[model samples]
Target: MLFGIILAYVSVGSVLIPLVLASFNWQNRSFEIRGLSILLLTSLICDASSMLLSRYHINTMPIVNFYLFAQFVILYLLFMRKLEIKNFLRVLLVLFCILCLIDISVFQGPYVLDTFSHIVGNLILMALSLYYFYTLLKELPTTYIHRLPFVWISFAALAYYSGNFFLFLLNNYLLKEAGSIAWMLHNGLNITKNVFFAIALWQAYHNRKLST
Candidate 1:
């Protein structure tokens, strides 16, 4: 039942966000904002794929690997290139991707290493997200401060990553019920993130239309 709630929140959030953003008057017109809208849409698609894998009890290695790779690429293109702090993150993501690939290809046993790698990858992603939000808030127009997408997206990221990090660290220590609780929180975070991104995209679109 809890798992169902997790899936519903994450899946619905992913689908609704892009649609809402694209429907907005402001987003449909501007090429730049439209590009970002598309990017988020793509991310949601990848996220759905990962969720599907989880639902079917399939091996999630390929799905997770591809998702992480896509995230790294998107962050690099959209946010990392402009910032100095992202240098380490870029390197870490590249290395992490390579490691995941190698692990699936070379190692046959011992899932512990994969768990470690995932923790590191999540940590790096969280760091990048923080930096991205910080930069967005710092540079966004003062007039739009209240309207900025990062407001929700940042909080979502924080919740998602923090839960993930805690879960990973306590996996061995926590009971099965505790693990389930952590997963619920993680899914909740994802839902929040998707919803926030959608709202931001719509807001951006609206702002763009008003300007033009």
Candidate 2:
């Protein structure tokens, strides 16, 4: 019962926290911040809708599939904007969509988790997040590293996906073994990520105010 609450409404609420935080000074935020805002908003819609649909006997896999691609695009663009990457990301996005379709339509089951597409997305985003971290470490882009918005945002993604990597890989087995403990950890991590995202939004908003 507690697990059900956490996985359902609590998880959805996590996304909403940062999203509402980001909404303040929406137009004044940088492109990177806006990208994060959009990501959180996407998450809010998908999670809430997915939960609602599930209660009504809907499949919800289609939303999950859409979310994977949309998640990739926003995060891909966010880092590309920051890391100054080139056109290759667009190519990768297209290829990823194809992979997702094939994975969903052919390989994945109706209610089974889409592990393949998730694993692929996690690896790519993790690589990008690490690369962004590498640049931050080498360049020392700001005097106060801890307060940097993207730093927090990058760390949020890194923390969530890196922790999620093995959980996702072991999800099927864990379902049979550990029960909801694995996914409970997942929901906890997701909530942590959103809290950091809210912190990042605060940093951005404060920095923007100081600048002007």
The model with the greatest lDDT is: 2
lDDT of 1 by residue, 16-100 (tens): 6556666674425444344455656676676677668778987656655555456545544444554566577567657877776
TM-scores of all candidate predictions against the true structure: 0.69, 0.89
Best by TM-score: 2
Candidate 2 lDDT score at position 40? 88
TM-score for model 1?
0.69
Q: lDDT of all predictions, in order shown?
A: 0.61, 0.81
Please give, for residues 113-159, the per-residue lDDT of candidate 2 as tens digits: 77888889899889989999998889988899978888888888898
- Residue-pair clashes, model 1: 2
- For model 2, the stretches where C-alpha displacement exceeds 4 angstroms are 109-111, 172-175
